[model samples]
Target: MSIEVSNESGMDVSEEDLISVARFAIARMNVHPAAELSMVLVDLDTMADLHVRWMDLPGPTDVMSFPMDELEPGGRPDSPMPGPAMLGDIVLCPAFAATQAKKAGHSLAHELALLTVHGVLHLLGFDHAEPDEEKEMFELQNSLLAEWLELRRQARREAQLAERDRRLLGKAGFFDA
Candidate 1:
């Protein structure tokens, strides 16, 4: 997928990390590889204003999505015609996410990662208003996130092991340190 990420938050989040999360989230939705997504990382005030104007919610939420070309409810979407399909924009508030991360005892990066996934799910037309829908949607979201996280953890472990092996070889004068 083509992911366009713009940071208006002035926060210190790594752009590469943000892009990685966006790509992972969109991919988990089984979107076409040619599909596109836009992400805007904004501060709390901007997100709060958007929340008030668009959603009419009181405060700044971590993430909000505005999808284009949404399919009808209960209708499965077909992949785009080998071209770019605009999935939607996900506006995320890093300030709000930091506060929420503090409250939830997690890193801000992790909170933003989760929010990105949540926003992408919204773009795919997942809602949790009713009890049954809530159960279904939350379960799916949680399971997908868990699986993705596990994969990332495994990749990190492999990378660390490779680094350690390289360091050992360097110490043995087999290669440059």
Candidate 2:
């Protein structure tokens, strides 16, 4: 998938991690491999303007999704053949998300990951406007985030082990300098 991320928030954030999480979410949702996605991290003022103009809200929101195409989960036997698509744009306000992260008792990175997944879901036509919809969407969002985080943890553990093995081999003169 072609996932592009641009940080215009004026704050130091991990662009790499955001890309990773977005790719994972899109793949998990069975989006086409050729699907393209764009994520923008904007400052509070920009977010507030978008919120007011698009949603008619008063203040900045954590994230906002503007879907480009009507896309559904593909790769199923009954589903249509997967093909290229422009998923949409996800605008995130990190300055706004920081407050939410504080209340949620998690790191900013974690909160951003969750928001990224949430934005993906919205792009795929998921909304929480009603009670039932909210439950289904939240459940899926939480599940996806949790699974992705676990995968990251597993990768870190594997990397650590690999490094340790390499160091041990070097110490024992098993590896050529």
Candidate 3:
């Protein structure tokens, strides 16, 4: 999967982290390998303009999704491969999302991760218009985020362990210093 991220918001947000999160979301959801995703971080003004033009809303939202080719989740390994497609664009307003992160008592990175997952789901045809739909979509979103975070933590722990082991080996004259 290819996830392109453009940070034009003029914020100090970590572009690498955003790209990693998008790649994780796409991979966990089993999206097609050839599917392309574009994530753009915009200023509030740009987000507001898009919010108005596309959604007819009056204010900038945290995130908005514009799907190109409607693609379904590839849940199974043997599932018939989907042809190359544009997974769509996920427009994020980092300036607006910062307020949300403060309100939610979480880091900006956390909020962005959640929003990224939400946007990807929207592109995959998930909606929360109804109560039941909201429950289903939110539950799935939360679960996906939780799982992805756990995976990240595990990877970090493993990396730390490997480094420690390497250090121990080096001290024991296991390799040329």
The number of the candidate with the highest TM-score is: 2
Residue-level lDDT of model 1, residues 46-127, one tens digit each, is 9989999998889788899899856433224453354347888999999999999999999988888888878878888888
Give the alpha carbon lDDT tens digit for every residue of 1-177 in model 3. 778899999998887777777787788778877889899999999999999999999989999999887567873355466544688999999999999999999999999999999998998889999999999999989998888889889999999999999999999999985
Which has the higher lDDT value, candidate number 1 or candidate number 3? 3
| lDDT string, candidate 2, 1-177, tens digits | 899999999989999899999999999988889889999999999999999999999989999999998777863345465654689999999999999999999999999999999999999999999999999999999999999999999999999999999999999999886
Model 1 earns a TM-score of 0.88
Positional deviation of 97 in candidate 2, in angstroms? 0.5
Worst 10 residues of 1 by lDDT: 71-80
TM-score of 2: 0.95
Arranged by lDDT with the best first, the candidates are 2, 3, 1
TM-score against native, each model: 0.88, 0.95, 0.90
Error of 1 at 56 (Å): 1.8
Q: List the residue pairs that clash in candidate 3.
A: none
- What lDDT score belongs to each candidate, Candidate 1 first? 0.81, 0.93, 0.88
Where does model 3 exceed 4 Å of error? 75-81
